[model samples]
Target: MRPQALLPWCLSLALAVPLVGLTPASARAATDYQAEDAVISQGTVATNHTGYTGTGFVDYTNVKGSYVEFSVSASAAGTSALTLRFANGTSTDRPMDLSVNGTVVASAVSFPATADWNTWATRTVDVPLTAGTNKIRATATTADGGPNLDRVSVAAAADTQAPTRPGQPSCSDIGEDGLTLAWGAATDNVGVTAYDLYEHGNKIAEAPGNATGKALTGLAPNTTYDLTVIARDAAGNTSPASLVVDCTTKPSSDTTPPTRPGTLAVSGVTANSADLSWGASTDDRAVTAYDIRSGTTVYQTVTSGTSATLTGLACDSPYTLNVVARDAAGNTSDQSNSVAFTTKACTTDGGVPSSIATLSTGWTIPWGTYWMPDGKTALVTERDDFRVWKVTKDGTRTQVGTVPNAVTTNGEGGLLGVAVDPKWDTNHHVYFMHTAAEGNRVVRMTYDGTTLSDYTVLLKGIKKNRYHNGGRLAFGPDGCLYVSTGEAQTPDLAQDKNSLNGKILRMTTDGKPAPGNPFGNYVYSYGHRNPQGLAFDRNGRLWEAEFGNSSKDELNLIKPGADYGWPTCEGSCNVAGMTNPKATWNVSEASPSGIAIVRNVVYMASLRGERLWRIPINGDNESVGTPTAYYVGTYGRLRTVTKVPGADQLWLSTTNCDNNGGAADGSDKLFRVTID
Candidate 1:
């Protein structure tokens, strides 16, 4: 049986789901109940597959009678659409019986293959529902069990409110043939479903609710047209028409091509995606779009922004990218300068994480974990409280001592990273990075097996903010101390080589700059936003993971004097001097924290993403493999992960008591994960 099979039954989640993509005739307000949050029999909640919504999905065992049941509520009893979003990777169809209340409403419902586990498809059925609450259950009829169940959305309540009026219509990129129309998004009680564009009271085009901009094409040249927009709700209620914009198209008979886009740059080149940006091109009419070419083939076409991200590229492969601008007359410009780049190598072990058991519990915001030289015990730090505890391998925890003079920033501050000196057996020195009244500081203390004493300040000068106080410390294989510092929410500090903030600092045991330093200062590598994870691979090469602002989070390979773009670049960009990340993930997928390497695999702990990521380091010792997430949404707010010395196992800790975690004190726990 899978380790997760032993977890307690999942409780029903009560949440509202927006009604989207529905036509007015069939629109109904809906609520989504995650499969993982429903009652399961002979199944487990899993995150191994991508595209599962609301944390995870219920993975059923290949046995008859496997089922997941959800409790749903409706305002009134009536016929409603029950949408089941699922994925089946196998070629064989998995048929299931859907039961409402206690009666089977749909029998032998076929769930066809969706290509792969990553691909999702939804099946909708009109079912009779009672007022108030109803129990909906789906059971596998054959030994193949049911398809991987994502969630079930019940559309019951009627949405009657119309969407608010859209913002006044505006025109841009006007040309002789066509122009671009844009307006602000309209608000709806349930959700806006679509928008209709009208020209002189006749509807000409339609766009999805999520879109605020539409490209108007196939219009007559040299003409004046008045355009307006109307927002529509799922129930077919249309908002008041937006104010009209009078746009005059340019004269016809023009065939001038646009100038080539300038200075094509790429950065944040990951295994599958690269960021591309170039100077805008000018045209006699209007530049309609920029076609990004991979060699001779157009990889992507950008219509609005000067930047475009190229995705779906192969790992560890070379690619030459150039941009060509196009005018309204279909005339194309010359190709821009070619920028040749190689995507980062991605490797994977395909290991699935099974919960062995919770090793320790009742701890609050356990921030850092580091094994002792003896390999039988480890020291842990609590972020909010300046306390240190020595935890044995068998789960015995003893509060050793608290670091004095440590102050809390009240958010993401207080006692943070803890690292035992590699020569601790002889020197008995242990180090800590914490927030102090002055700023963030690195301090050294003497640990004599059972207790901690002799506190001494090693280094200071790293600025601290209410947030972004980077506080992770480790001793590199070269016997030098490596510290990861945050930018203190100051983006400029990351690009400033002279500032210690937003940098990976390398220092001696006494806190002076390490020998052969990059800038003759403590700064080893500049340009980091909020670097938290720092671990050395088996090849003695450093790897770091940090949080991204709004778009992407990054996992980068650290090098001496390498500049990692911060405010200037989020994920992958084509900046000239900035180094790109080896892997990039959506911020919703990886607000990463501490990382540890075991058997050449870097295990990263995510905070907001709430998962443990395993990324394999290739034999080349430089590029990383495809990153896979494990225990996603199963554990809340993973804070730190550390390799158990001399073992193929890792110790993971959680910070459920943090502000974002929102759990009560003593709600956190420590877990042990074995890599197979």
Candidate 2:
């Protein structure tokens, strides 16, 4: 006979133990409720059982369908191992079924006798359990009923808490047919399983929980959408919805090119540069920029304008040039009629100048100087005085007039930048960027040879601070005005596209944003800390110089719609999504203010470093060579450097009267330096 089979009834009585609610130390971690402690029907706690844990086991009546139900608690909803301890005195095997909650997990499970009622055995099965409390029962299946039943043990399989809500979603790469969405990851008690994307209250896409971004396709052009995300766990528990985001698709792709440029012509040919103009091109999507080419090579790319200056050519050399127009969608037009011209013979020695000549002296903070159409007289703006003066080539200074409504508070804010209109002979209009009672503004005034009048406000709403009141203005080769601004001591303003502060703005003479600006705004390039220098290279590429905050200064190449990281990055850093500077300088060495490009070389005037920097331009004007400093600590606080029209000379101004330089009265001066 099997050892589990019954021996005799007398042996069962001898092995009976007294009933007691005692739990074993071995089952301390798992919940072990005594079988007798459970809800029983047609069963009773009997001392006839030996070798059973937790009080006396439950003995069912000798009839089918008798059961003992126990309440089990699970910390999480997952698979749990259930162990049943029992013994049978009869020789026959008793069959039972296990039910968890309301569902039966195992039917007709065999419980064989273990060498009489004194012997015990365990039957284990894994069953699914819900979180919180649950019911598990063992019911007899045969007429002999089930064997003696002991405690029910339940342990949690894993944690069941849902993941934390995901962060706000952002959209990028918004093409006409697709978009890329990204968000921060969510945290969970166990682990996140997946992320579900919802659009307009309906599920649209999914990503791995570890992924923070998703790319979607098949989107309609010029459409807007409301999107969100949710995180889930392995247990199917979902987190709260993430913040909603509104995204709009770009307009349809513009495959049509602009009409071929016409009437190309060259004039004002210098020894190393030539001025070229062409008739305007027509386009369905508006022209953005034009490329002036020599044969198949691009010589210069200027903003949507008719004229550009090609510099750095051999003296008296003949060259063929053509013009091609391009739209914002990267469509290029056919080349215009070619024009051939020879450069003028060199008038100066073909080498950079090593000496500077003092043209004028005794000025108090000369901020800007622009050469007049006659090329002999220049207009200068005094920062603190709010005065416009006409300085002759021989150091004759005459006050033209003070701009009306101009105000100066902090030492930095006052009359700043000045620009002469390209059609100055006919319009006689000159523009100025200055501080006023309201804010910083750009205004145009009439210059009638002797005096200034007819002031008109062109642009306004540029915030100003004691420092970082960037006020630099220049007319690009495209005939549009380019203005540089500062962040006004507000770090976040540099990254804000809608703010006028901390940006390089491209606008028409009347102050409207130039057509085809990256974002329908006056902002051309943003994310500047305190940019004060704006210059276009021989190839019409824009370059900027910015004063750094105690760390490093920067010289950057400006690109439309590109972000130059401020507050996040101070110098060259391997940061994603931010444009890096072309060159960097220690703050003490170069607080570069104004920059000018001549013959493929960039000249930057320094304030704190008290020097000038010459950086040679490389291929396509995309990069710069090593920077060489000149006159370090000799000239005090050089402020502005402007190219002398039709000459190899540049006019450099001094700012020794301002707070930083701390020079005596009449110490500031303007010097002319001839550079090759």
Candidate 3:
């Protein structure tokens, strides 16, 4: 029996499923929920859900690069919420995020996973739900970046009570002699944490002894004010603010300045404000007020605890701020130090793109491209979410297919490279380098905008490790598939031409070689280091674009029987028969992944450089031009480049999603560039 088969009856998930929910035709996106009422939650009750509905599998095997869409029915369709209660069945303590439909629902930090394979943790993502079978997928994400889903209960729409209305702040009351402020207790299904009290607008005291509560205190007489309370449960959910209470403060001059904060530092800086954050500032009586200074001028003031946001500042400039504390009894402390930062530099370097525009939507992870059969659209491949998108001259893209039973995700599996058949108009076929269960394989598939099928395996036996299968497929001038496979990390395998690793594969359109004398239809040339790009110039000479082993990246001209050194001679060397690079860049400058020869110019995408190096392709073996850098760092890391149909522009793909912390607003992208 499989490991999951030995599990107890209560937590078992069955692989074979009977999905009785909405059909694909009835699928639609959910909108935001209006008029939120009080939310209530209860403690988790252990119920034996052995045979639930819709895609439940107790024997959950590895579904790498694929989404496990639970097709369970909702209680009343719109009365649906999502909860991921799962057991970590593996030793690897990898983390992943959860998503609903196509929208990003949460990050790993928001839903932290555990490596304690024996225990189970449940997380909930309460979003607006639609009627019918809501396809809830447990998406897998990791820092090293691969998809690995363990056991999870995706379809458990159990009948439970509403969690308390959460995320509200506490309140405080002030009276003439002394005030009495009371707030509702922080409530949750698990338990409440604490309550905080606020007076007038300031927190005067705390209740419940924890991070929760509302407080009451003395004040000036005859001043009318409103009071509110909030609650926080143990699971970190806070309740809604309660109804307001009217109060009056007694007259008394509590004119003491709040104690001065000790050391202060400028935390977050943007165009508008410097988020002034510091450690907890103390007070003798109570921290009543704060003063902010710019250089030596009394700039502004605030009454808060430790930190406050200093807003209304200049962009792309330097500024400094100082903060002072005061107590309620009119005692003032010295000003805090270390609040300074340089503002956002929009134009640090002289060379950045002045304008950018969107190209297409629904095309994900687009990494490389080949011109379609009609010469009107280019068939593009992506990094993750591997699907083929057809990019046309008008800047529109349509997702053709995910792959031939291929998953678009995991660390490196996806639709990678697309090669249109030379007789594509008649044959109606295209070859793709994609990830599969058997490993990396070259597949021939039929394509329309929404449908994909008729998969014929062109070449099968490639070793698909988790990383670097070197999947780039292209048709040579001789009308043959000149495929490039990486040695991955097995360097010794690269030196052996007998194996597919580290060699350029030469085969007929259907995985056979052109009638040649080079080893009878197998190895074209040997010695390669992740040869990700293959293209021919107008001169009909084949050039390879490859990143070196942690050193210099090089572009080499392929000779029929030459060795373009891999683990041996990197960058360039003084050796015989081993081809030297015509141009070289340090590893920092070029993780040069993909290149395209357009109008006698080779445009190469730099994943590390975050720029496109336009090298003039003089001929098959020759390339000149001073190499211009375009769109450096505006978009993060660029991966692939494909020439626009009969034009000077090329489409570039950004690679920030492959486990890099890109900006929240901007991560991986597809850029269109026009070379001068």
Candidate 4:
């Protein structure tokens, strides 16, 4: 019956084991199932199948009167969980209620649809779990009569104990290197503790019972050994020793030099010896000089620009030369493809600047850069971490003022995009986009170059999604402040002009939208995903760069009352009413964030692609230019791009550390761009 019902009795045996069809168990479990907590989407699932399989399932047999309860506890108490393929369905999509301890913790009426299972799909249910058995009851409810508990299947609790070591025998092979081993953990009422490792079945090392990870290190290189570990529990009950795992250490570091290049050929040959050279390579990440042999005698070793000449040999006298590439680490690549050829005179290419030079002084997360009326002090937005910086022409950086209660340090939630008050030197005003306690807000910081004073809260309460708040504050030539916002994953908000989410709001120095916005002059434009990077040229045209998760990044020129489709469309909108991007980037090469117009070109900063691009514009809301690849691999990430006062230099910020996984030590740097 019930396939032997794989199970064990916890502390509370609740002996009332009801038969499958004995009672009408619908009244007590249906109505009480609040869809608030049953959505446990973050647990581990079995990944052994070619596609996806589940070690976890929902049970609906224990339902009563519009409510469902768990046999013991909720899903969180689980130490190990079942993982399904991302293409699989959602927890609630199958009509399930997650329960633990006769209480419904999480329930879902509708499963949120998504392709990526990492970000939006992990819904934490509200129910709590105890230290015993757990069950998730999935039941349905009918308004008129009844038909909800149709598909009911119960999943037996998972067994975390390690299987017994099958057929223990004798292993005598041993090596110099340290040993590598692995084993399964013991099952438990809750979870197992550390695992005790053994050599020759004797206690050696103790590893954590966490199954998702492994441990192997310390010993002689190139050695072999047998190892095994026993899963131990906090309660002192140990599982059988797992089967022995055999492993070997790595071989000695490869350091042999490559063979010499042979078979030199003549191509584009001339009377004068053609320049001869071999390809360059690095060994162990180090590059050593190349050894060249002319005839039977040995030639000098060249560090760079492979290929040496044959001098003092009779004109056109056949000669054999070999080229070998070596590295500083004493490791060399295979000899390059052999080439037989004559000597060629070398020529020089003229005049490349030692390297492009730009002034990066006074730059600290300068999302927005502009010159005060006097053109002496450059006002750049310092973001929330650095606020506003008042720097003189000589590169003196000073803080304007900080917005109190700022600093989100979470995904795109923090102080971002900044703009100078159209009349900065005259009116002493500055504006910024920051996350307040409530939500994303656009505020103004008032200051006089020397002593900054007072912060004015202009706009607040805009919808804030962790990763996409669309922060790019700019002041149009009309002297109106523009704040771009994100949709917060709520698709409907993008089309709702009245809602601040997914919109570009044009407001006065204070928080009120400009007097003449599209909707009663309150909302500037609607329908945007996450629009960052905004700028207006001398011609008074606004352009913005936006980030799309899987699609192309866009360089959009904002038009009043126009909709840059968000949830409805990504790029190249074939939809009836949607705006298209002026230019689309692959996101890898250009997640364009901050933009600055200079010398009739739009210099936009790329986030994922740490480079600055100068797109030439023709005043037609479009641009063309050869994107200059800079800091190429030098800086891990780039965020905001802007132009300096002289009009020839550009500025951008690196966001490696800001996004986590980045080194905290000076990994984030401000780069200066000078256009030659």
lDDT of each: 0.82, 0.80, 0.57, 0.54
lDDT of 3 by residue, 631-674 (tens): 54456677787776665667777666664323332245666666
- lDDT-sorted candidate list, best first: 1, 2, 3, 4
Runs in model 1 deviating more than 4 A are 1-355
Q: How accurate is candidate 2 locally (lDDT)?
A: 0.80
State candidate 4's TM-score. 0.48
Pick by TM-score: which candidate is best?
1
TM-score of each: 0.50, 0.49, 0.47, 0.48
| Tens digit per residue, CA lDDT, model 2, 262-283 | 8998888876678888899999
Per-model RMSD to reference: 28.5, 30.9, 24.9, 20.2
User: Residues 1-676, candidate 4, lDDT per residue (tens digit)?
Assistant: 1123212221012122221111111111211222223332222223332322223222222233334332433333543221111222323243344445455554543333344233223232334434465555433332211112211222223332432322232233333333335343355555566666554322445667565234444544554445555555543334444555566655536545555444444344543333456655545445557765443223335666655653222123234555666654344455555446643332212111122333344333445566666667766665537566666644567776666666663456777776677556566777778877667777776766765567767667675544567888776666667888876544456776657777888776655556546665446777787788888776677888887766577878788888888767777679877888777766656667778777667777776665565566754435543333334344556777666675466655666665332446334555555654
Deviating ranges (above 4 Å) for candidate 3: 1-357, 361-363, 407-410, 448-450, 619-625, 661-667
**How big is the positional error of residue 479 in model 2, measured in Å on the Cα after superposition?**
0.8
Give per-candidate clash totals: 12, 4, 51, 52
Clashes (candidate 1): 12
Q: List the residue pairs that clash in candidate 2.
A: 3-115, 4-113, 4-114, 4-115
